[model samples]
Target: MPEHGHKTPHLQEHLLNIPVPDYAPELRQLVFDYTLQLADTSLILGHRLSEWCGHGPILEQDLAMANIALDLIGETRSLYQYAATLEGKGRTEDDLAYLRSAVEYKNPLLVEQPNGDFGDTVMRQFLFDGFHYFLLKALKHSSDQGLSAIAAKSFKEASYHIKWSSEWVIRLGDGTEESKHRMEKAVGNLWMYSGELFMMTDTEKQLLEAGILPDYTSIKQQWDEHVAKVFSEATLEVPQQVYMQQGGKMGKHSEHLGYILTELQYLQRTYPGLEW
Candidate 1:
C-alpha cells in the first residue's frame, strides 16, 4: 500500500516502492516546501535564460545558452509534474509554472537576477550550475521514485551544464583584461547569494536520515572544490562576502519575478484554463 495515503497510480507501475518513514508534521511540511522550491527555482531560471535566445554575445554562445535554457525548461516541467503529484492535486505542470505569483514562487533570487553581460550571465550560471550539479548528485538516491528519476536524468544534463558554464567562466575570466575584470565583478556580485544553496532545514535532515537524500553540507564540499577549480582556471578571485540575500526558499522573491510572471501568466490568466 502507498504510504501517507498518497495515491500514485501513474507512478507506481513505473517505480519501485519507497516507504515513507515516521516523521512529525513539520518535517513533512519541510519536505513539501523544499520540493516546491526546487521546482520553482528551475522554472523561473529556465524562463530567464530563455530571454537570451537570440541575444547571446555570439551565435555559438547564443545557441549554447539556448540549449541549456531548453534543458532547464524540460527539467522544470518534470519537477512541477512530480510536485503536483506530491501535492495530490489535479493541477498540471503548466498550471503551476504559468499561474503562480512571484510571492508563490520559491526560486532563489540569484537565478532571477538581471543578465547584464555575457560575463555576468556566465558567472551567474557558473555559481548556480556548480551547486546544481552537486545537489543532483545527492538527489539521485532519493526514496521518491519520481524525484529520483528526475534527478538522475538531470544529473547527466547538469554535467554538461557545469562544463558549458565553467568553460564560459574561464573564457571570460582569462580572455581579455576587460573580460577578466567584468567576470570578477560578476562573481563578487553573485557570491553573497551562494550560501542559500546549502542551507539545511528540518525537512532535509529527515530526508537524509531516511536515506532518501544526501546531506547538503557534504555536497557543499564538492561544490566548493569544483567552483574553486573553475575560478582558478578562469583567473578569477572568489569573493569573501558573507552578507547575502535570503527568503527565496520561503516564496519571497525579488521584484523582477513579478514582472516576468505577469508576462508569462497573461494569456493563462485571461483565458482561465484554456488549452490548445
Candidate 2:
C-alpha cells in the first residue's frame, strides 16, 4: 500500500533496470504473446492467493499466503512491463493489466480457477507450482535474453512456493479423516485443470522452434515425478482417467475469468490513471 499524498516512484523507472537484448522483428509478436501468457498466469494465481490474506487457517499461514501472493505479483509486473515494451503501443504495464478484456488474458485454465477451501487452495497452488517450478527452469535457458532473465529471477521464489504448497498438501492429505477427505475433494476439483498446462498453442510452438522454450512434455515429466513422489508420501491417489479442459492459453477461458476481471479491473476502470 502507498502512503497518502506522497508520490510513489514511477513503475517504468524500475522496468528500465531490466536488460532486454536486441531481437529480430519477427520475434517481437511471438515474445509479446508468450510473455503475456506467463504474466497472466502469475497475476491470476496471485490474486487468488490474495483472497486468503486474512482468511488462512492460522496466522502464520496467513502471512505465508500473503508472501507468496506478493512473490507472484512481483513476477507478473516484470513480465507485463516486458510485454508492454514488446508491443510498442505506448501501453504501460498498468494498461496491459487493467484494461484488457478477460478474453485477451492468456493464463492457463488451471490458474484462474477459484480458490475454494483452504484444502482446495492448497491443492490448486501445489498443482500450479509443480508446473511453474519446472517451466521457469526451462525458461531460464531461453534464446530470448529478457525471458531468460525474468525466469531466472522468478525461479528462486517458485522453488520455495512449491515446497510450501506440497508440504501443506501432504500435511492435509495424510492427516485425520476429515482433513484427508477435504484433500481428496480438492484433488478431484483441480486435477482436470492440470492437463491444460501442457497443451500448446501456435505461440508456444513458435517459441519452441526458436529455442525460447522447452517442450511441454519435458516439463510435464518433471511435474509428474515430483507430484507422484509427494502424493505417495501423502497417501493420496492420483486420478486415473480424466478429460482435460483446454483453450485458456489462446484466450478461451472458463466462465470464472469474466467475474474475476470484474473485480480485479474495477479500481483501475473506475479511476483511470490513478495509482498510489
Candidate 3:
C-alpha cells in the first residue's frame, strides 16, 4: 500500500487531486474531450505494442518491448480511470474504452500504424516519446491535481522510456548499414504524422485558461530541442517533411483503430459485464 492509505493498484497511486476548470457543462465536456484524446493515443499505442508479445527480435528485446508496453498500458488505465471519475455520469473505464464507437476515439493516426519491423517500432517510439516527455513535464504544473500528480509520477517512468528508446535509436542508426537504412526509412515514414500530436483544440484552450492543463505551444519548443538533441546523438537527421497530417483530437482516427477495437473489445462485446 502507498502512503495514501490504499494499496496502489499498479499505476493508480498517481491519481492526485489537481483542480480542473469550473466551466459549465459544455466547457467541462470540452476539457474531457481533450483529456480523452491524450488517453486514447497511449491506450491504442499500448494495444499495438502488446501484439508484439511473442514475436520480438530476441528474448531480451521481447521482454523490453513488453515492459514498455506494460508501462503505457499502466499509464492508460490511470488516465482513463480518472477521466471516468470526472465524467460523473456513472461511466466506467471499460465502458468508455470498449463501448465507444470508432468515431469517438481521439487517438492520433501515428499510433495506429502497423508495427512493421523493430526499426519501425523504435522509430515510432522515438518520435512519440519525445513529445510525451515534454507534454508530461508541462503537465506537472497542471491546475488539475489528478493530472499533475499523474504527470509528476509518470514523468520519471517516461524519462526511462526516452532513455531506453534513444539508446536503440542510436544503436540502430550507427550499428550497421542495414540497420541504418531501415531506421532512416522508418523515420521518414513516421515523420509526416508527428505534427498532429502537438496540435491543440478549444478544450485545451479552456483548460489552459483555467490552469487545468499546460500550454502545448511552449511544450512544442521544448520538444523540438529534445528531439533535435536525441537525433544528433543518434547520428540521424530530422526529416524536413513538407506536409503534416492532423485531426485526431476531434474523435477522428485512422483506419486501423477500427480493427484494433474489434480485437480489444471482443471479450466485452461478446460477454457483457463479464470480469475475471
Candidate 4:
C-alpha cells in the first residue's frame, strides 16, 4: 500500500525539484495548502487501491489495480516533496505523509470512503478519475512552472485511469443482470460523494485566480458531461440535485479518516523518526 519509503532524498533528489518563490507570502501559503491536499487525496486513494493488490477478482485486473495504485502513490510522493519544500518548516516528505493527524488530512470525504466491494471501488475510481482527468488538463497550463511540470507528468496517468475505470463502469452497468444491479447500487451509494470534488474553498478560489489551478465550476461541468456520457452508455442514470458534502478542505472529515490515519501513521508513530 505504501509507495516509496517514508524517507527519500528531499526535493533535491530531482533536477526539477527546485522550489522557487513563485508567489507572495499569502499566495505561497495557499499553494502549500492546495499541494498538500492533492498529495493527501492521492495517498489515501492509492492505499485503498493497494488493498486489491493480491485480491483482484481476476489476475489481469489485480495487476492493473496494483499498477494504478503505484501510479497514484508515485504522484503522491512528488506532490508531498513539493509540499514539503513550500512549507519551509524543515519537514521531510515522510513527516508530512506519515505524521499528519486525521483532521490534518485534506482529502475529500469521497476518497476516504471504504472500498465496499469491487463494484463500489470501480464506481469510486471512475468518479474521481473523471474529475482528475480534467483537473490535470487545466493544471498543465499552470503559471507555476513547478506545478505545471508535475501536472504534465501526471496527465497521461490520469488519462489512462479514466479510460480503464470508464470501461469497467460501462461493462458493469451493461453487463449481466446481477452486474448491472450491483453497479446501480454502487452508483447510488457513491453519487453524493461526487459533489465534494468540485466544492472549492477560499484557498482553491485564490489559486484558481492565481492561475495555479483551474476553476472547479468549469471542471465540474466537464466532469458531469463525461460522466453522463459514460453512464448513459452503461444504461445508468446520473443523479442530480443531490446534497453535496463539504469540509474536507477545511479539515473536517467523516469517521473513516480516523481509522485510516491510525493505520497509516502507526509505523511512523511507533518508530518516531526513522523510515521503516
Candidate 5:
C-alpha cells in the first residue's frame, strides 16, 4: 500500500489556503449552507462506505471500497474547512464534522440510509455518484473560487466513483438471478431518496440567482438521462414513482442520521479536544 502521509501537507495547504471571495452577508451565508450540504453528504456516504472496510466479499473489492471511502472523507475535510472559513465563526473543520447534531447536518437522506447488503450499497453509491458527477461538473464553474477549486478536485474522484458503481450495478443486474433480484430490490428501496439530490432549497435558489451555483433544473434532466442509460444497460427497471422524499436540505433528516452521528461523534464527544 502507498503511504498517504506524503500527501497530507499538500492537502492541508489546499484546504487552509483557498481564498475566500468577498460577498454580501446573505450570499456568504447561502454559500456556507451550500458548502455544509456538500460536506455533510460526502462525510455521511463516506462513513457508509467505511462500514464495508473488512467485510467485502473479495479482498480486492474490500481495498477498493476502503480507498474510495478515504477519498470521500478527504473531500469532506476540504469542504468542511472551506465552510468553517465562510462561517467566520472560529469553527474548525473538526467542529463542523464532529460536533454538530443530526438536525444540523444537511446531508441528503439517501446517504444516511442503512447499507442493507452489498447490492444495496452499490445501488446507493451509483445513484449518488451519478448525481454528484453532474453537480461537481457544474460547480467547477462556480463564482466562488474556493468552491470551484474544491469542485474541481472532487469531480475527478466522483468520476471514478460513478464508473465503479455504475459498472457494479450493471454487473449485478445482468448476472445471476439472485444478484439481479438483490440489485433490483436495492434500486426500488433507494429510488425515493434519490429525488432529494435535485431538490433546491431557498439558499440554493439565492445562490442560483447570484450565479454562485448552477441551475439544478437542467442538471436533473442530465441526471435522468445518465441514470436511464445505466439502468437500461443494467437491465433494471427505473422506478417511475413521482412521490419523492425530501427535507434533508432543510436539516430535517431520517432517523438513520442519528445513529450515524452517535458512532461518528463518539470519539469527539467522549474525549473532547482529543486528536492524533
Candidate 6:
C-alpha cells in the first residue's frame, strides 16, 4: 500500500509508464478532464462535510464526519496531483483545487448541495457513496495504471464511507417518526441530482472509448440494486422516477456552488499564494 502522506513513487512511475498511443495529446486532455471531475467531486464534498467539523449531532459522529472529510480531501489531493501532471500546465494540485472558478468545477451538483440536517447530510452521503463505491470498484481495472492505483487506494475509503452512510440511512429511516419523515424528505429532494451520476459527458465518453474510464451503465444498475436493498431494509421508499437534474458535470451548477466557492476560495484569492 502507498503511504498516506507524501508522494507515492509507484503512482508517479505508473503514470510515467502509461503507454501513449498516437493521439497522445487528445488522450491526455480527455484524461485530464476526467480526473478533474473526480477531484472536483471529492474536493467540493470534502468542504461540505468539513462544515460539520464541530457541529455533528454527537461527539463520536462529529469525529467520524471530520475524519471522513479529511479522507476525502486526501483523495482529492491525489487526484488533483495526477490531473495536474496530465494537463502539463505547470499547475499544482493546490492550483487546480483552490484557484478554480465555480463554473470551472466539474463536480456533480449533488455534492455541492448544502448539508441540510443530519438526515439530509447522511442521505446525500449515502447516495453519493453508493455511486462512488461502484465507480471506484470499476476504475480499479482501468487501463491507465495511474488511475488504477488511485482507485485501488481510494476504494478502501469509499467502502467505509458507503457502509457508514448506508447504516445511517437505515438507522434514521427506521428510528422514529420524525427521523423517518426527515429521511424521506431528504431522499425525495436529492433524487433528482442522483441521475447525473450515471449520465456520461463527452469527456467520459472519450475516456470510455480509450479504456481509461469505466462503463457507467453497469455501475448504475449496481447502484440501483444497492440503494434498493438499503432502502428496503430501512423501510423507506425510493422516490418515484422523475426528470433528473443535469449540467453540473458540464460546468453548469446550481446557485449553491457559488456560495461554497466564495468561502473555499476566499483566503487563497485574497492572499494570492498563501500557504498554511
What is the C-alpha lDDT profile of model 3 across 32-113, one tens digit per residue?
A: 7766887788888888888999999999989888888888877777777778877878888789888887888988888888
Candidate number that wins on lDDT, 1 or 4: 4
Superior candidate under lDDT, 2 versus 4 = 2
**lDDT, candidates in the order shown:** 0.78, 0.90, 0.81, 0.88, 0.90, 0.89
TM-score per prediction, in order, is 0.87, 0.93, 0.90, 0.93, 0.95, 0.92
Per-residue lDDT of 180 in model 4:
96
Pairing residues by index, what is the TM-score of model 5?
Answer: 0.95
Candidate 4 stretches with Cα past 4 Å from truth are 1-15
Candidate achieving higher lDDT, 1 or 3? 3
Colliding residue pairs in candidate 4: none
Q: Candidate 1's error at 189, in angstroms? A: 1.7
Model 5 CA lDDT for position 268 = 97
- Winner by TM-score: 5
Supply candidate 2's per-residue lDDT for 247. 84
Worst 10 residues of 4 by lDDT: 7-16
Model 1 agreement with the true structure over 99-204: per-residue lDDT tens digits: 8778888788888888888888888888899889988987888766666788988889899999998998888888998998898789777887788777765566
Error of 6 at 259 (Å): 0.8
lDDT per residue (tens digit) for residues 16-133 in model 2: 3555557687788888999999999999999989989898889999999999998999899999999888887899889999999988999999988888899999999999999999
| Number of clashing residue pairs, candidate 2 | 0
RMSD of each: 7.5, 3.3, 3.6, 4.2, 2.0, 4.0
